[model samples]
Target: MDHKKVMIFLLSSMLFISSSGSITAGESSEKIKAKLENIDYGDITLKDSAKVKPSFNLQEVSSNETKQNFYDERIPKVNLESGAVISQKNKQIEIPFTQPLDSTDEALYSHDLVIKQLGLANTPTLIPVMEYTTRVEGNQIIITFLVDYTDEYSVQVKDPYFIRSNGNLATPSDVYITTKNAPVNVDSPKVSLESGTVIPQINKEIEIPFTQPLDSTNEALYAHDLVIKQLGLTNTPTLIPMMDYTTRVEGNKIIVTFLVNYTDVFSVQVKDPHFIRSNGNLASPSEVYITTSNTPVTIESPKVSLESGTRITQSNKEIEIPFKQPLDSTDEALYAHDLVIKQLGLINTPTLIPMVEYTTRVEGNKIIVTFLVDYTDEYAVQVRDALFIRSNGIPAIQSEFYTTTKNDQLIVD
Candidate 1:
């Protein structure tokens, strides 16, 4: 029988045996039931009575679900004893402790550990940690680096701040790292040019973005050492003098600005750039070849070759032209054949002059146009091609300045 039923039967038997009445068993049974119902079982204390406790198999049943959970699985309920233990600096370093963790896969990459920095670069320098790592054998953290900046680094743990052990962070100051001299790898210092390095125009600044700073203090020295060559097919190598350029290092880029104006293919490179890292490491001399875009030449307007350069009091059949830059004297002949002198008729229709004779000459920055015949009525002139070449060998943009003028009246149309 069950415990409850057995107890009730034994109690009833004792009651029947103790009865001093000359009564039947069936009558005694009914009286026992009524007496048992009247008994106050709620007043009993089972824990207090040793005798009752041994007789019944009484145990408490509960449904108090799960006890506790972790906020971050990587952070275990570590024992607070001492700080961490870092070993050495190499491609990898291990921070170990004493205890079993609930997981072997550490959820560490998320923190950087606040690990004081991040991300990789191809040396020229600051050797950053590998972008992410997740290897941790219970109680020990293994960090793999992108670059072994130092051969031997003493590992340790103290703290004002970071490194995730004790379920807290140990900052760079927390973990003592002694870095030694980096091995001299010829390919150690690396760099790349930002896109669109080719300059489209002249007399503007071009920035050379570098991985590390160049010797910032030597502006004049860099300008002297660096060379800029204006490249062309047929002429000897024309060098843009250092006096016509300016160099400076601003925001990790060497900004070489042009002071003089010209348009052609040009190359810039450092002779001995003296690229220096913040830690005082020097990068070897290297060649950086970049080309500036070669664009067409250009000019200012043209007017009558008079004292006023106007046709107010018609004097001679000549035109004076001003150009953007000095003309290459050799290409002066190239400009002559391309000139189209015409007459704007009374109806504003242009009539081309079939036999026009003119001689072109470069007078300083001006081109004086002396027409051989005096055929002035309402003359207009226009270029037919990019013929006027600059001293730097770049031609002027085509068919510019369609100038018009008339005889006698105040006209330089």
Candidate 2:
């Protein structure tokens, strides 16, 4: 055999034996100890000599490995109702959760897997607390949750929403009234005159001024009638004659006037002015007089009689009597006496009584006549003439008288 071939074979055999021994040694306690020494349990303060209990049991270790797989399978199966899938291929799918992933272990693993596959955090994740149920129907997911997390989180991020509608805010229009111009000041006196008096008829047109500028078209602003309200006078609402005026504008004022009638003076009594006496006598004229300061005033009788008769005295005034004759009576003489008293303006009418007795005797061709009167009362009697003689031959007359009663009730001749 050649020495070079022998050297190659021996080197190959040695290399094979060394490799087998290394494999067996790697599976031994020495390798296990080395691995355990290099691991840090995090914040364990035990000294090198201290006896530390192993936190990991072989059974638990095995179960933990199984639980890791269990968590991965169960978490995805949770359906994360409030989330959606961004990408998927074959049996694997990438879902975009509504919120950040929360589980510590799962989040780390999912992050690594997602970064490796998607090359970014684009595989959206959610907190374990946010996982909910969703029903997939066609391209849409009917998501439902025990708690609504979207709205709860949005309140912290955005403003509230509102709606707009018609007739929300409005304003109204304005209305007003206007008037015309008229004369402000004018003086007019109301006068009453007697009938049959001739008066001056002035037809001159006067212009009345108004206080404020007025629209003449507005009749309400114009004077419909001359309203003369008597302030100091006792009577009210005196009606004055209506006069039309021509309107003229001088600066800002108006002036108005009317032509009044004038008449001549005449004298007449305003009242009956006289009275009648009870016994057909007249009172003194001074008792029935009246005078006025105004001239051209008409005086008319009241057309009625007072209790006294008319009697004019030296005082230049008519006086009243106690009685007057009745105007309406069935007695002709009484009515005639009344007419006479009225014509004379006497206060009363005289009362007439019948002549009671007449005495006649013939004495030597001469006739002597005696007259007597009877009054109802003794005080009413008055003897004027007792006797009168008529001579037949010469047509001569004679008279004589004698009184007997205290009231002169008897007469003799």
Candidate 3:
């Protein structure tokens, strides 16, 4: 009976030990399953036995999203000691400070902070800052300042400023006043034509227009001082008034017309050589024939011959004849007789007697007639006697020859 009781106690003790082992094994299995489900493969933990708790917040689950939000929030709140605010409201921001940050701020900073926040890489080196009282009106913001700083600052800032650091701020530029002195003692302007330059005859009237208008108050400014220089000419400049000029503008070009008064300085010279001839004495009619070496000439009623060879008549009526022949005594006598008869008709015939003598000679390609006549009737009568001969063998007598006698009238050949 004792042996039976010992068996029952041993069996009960073995059953209890078996149940405790199963319970411990089941608890370990549950803990292992929970750790396996919660463990982050991305994170490295030094303690293998340590348990990892599951994060309940949806945002905490995404490491990338958490980092992005942190950066976005941190960038906008950045402020500089220079009173510059780096915020999302101002699309453009400029920073001027250049210094290392102290340990008081534990935030992570980067040079690309503005770039990353704004999603813009190429920002202006220096950006102007404007601050004024702003009022919200509907969808727009109306900003006003009692004493605006931007205008004053712009006057002071001559060149663009370069940004040196992030979150740095600068005061607005200062106001400046610049004064310049007016030009002094400006002489009147002048227009000059180039030397040896020939302008079109039709374009004698020219008007020159200025790129910029002259002062209306100063009349001298409107006056044009012009100088014209030509080849083989004196260097005297001509002056004219600009107000009298006319102008027209075609695109960017100016057409100027000047009322120019031009004068020719050189005088033309004319010359000719001529000869006067008679039969014997200067009292008789003479003939004149002109020879010109240069320009052509016109004679006004040029009396080639005259009964009184002492004088020649040149009047309003003119006659033109080219120089071709050598004038001599015979030609002179014939010309004089013909002129008297033709002009005064046969009724006005004054017994014509040659009073001049001409000695004709030929020199090279030219013919010359020398005058040798004096105003004397005796010399004319002597010439007439020498030229005339008795008709039909009758002895020629001066008185009977010229007078009408008996039944015979005086005749001359």
Q: Which structure among the candidates has the greatest TM-score?
A: 1
Q: Write the per-residue lDDT of candidate 3 for residues 1-413, one digit (tens) a residue.
A: 34333333433332222222221222343454443444234443335223423233333435987777755543322233422222222222232222322212212222122221110122122221222332322222222323322211111222212211233322223222111122321222221223222223234343332223332221222122222221112222333335433334332222334454442211111112010001100011112111111222222212112132222211222111111222222223222222111122245534433223433233322223233532122111111221111111111122111111122332333
* Candidate 3 Cα outliers beyond 4 Å, as residue runs: 1-199, 206-233, 241-246, 251-253, 264-413
Instruction: Summarize candidate 1's per-residue lDDT along 2-82 as a digit string, tens digits.
Output: 444455576667443224322223347667766555544554444433444212211222222311223233343323223
C-alpha local distance difference test of each model:
0.46, 0.23, 0.25
- Candidate 1: which pairs clash? 112-115, 161-171, 162-169, 162-170, 162-171, 163-170, 297-395, 297-396
- TM-score rank, highest first? 1, 3, 2
Give the per-residue lDDT of model 2 (tens digit) for 180-275.
112211222111233322222123322322223322221221222223221111232332333422223332222222333212111211121111
Q: Quickly count the clashes in candidate 2.
A: 43
Per-model C-alpha RMSD: 18.6, 48.1, 38.5
Which candidate tops lDDT?
A: 1
> After best superposition, candidate 1 residue 388: deviation in angstroms?
6.8
How big is the positional error of residue 33 in model 3, measured in Å on the Cα after superposition? 56
Query: What ranking emerges by lDDT with the best candidate at the front?
Result: 1, 3, 2
TM-score of each: 0.28, 0.14, 0.14
Model 1 accuracy (lDDT, Cα) = 0.46
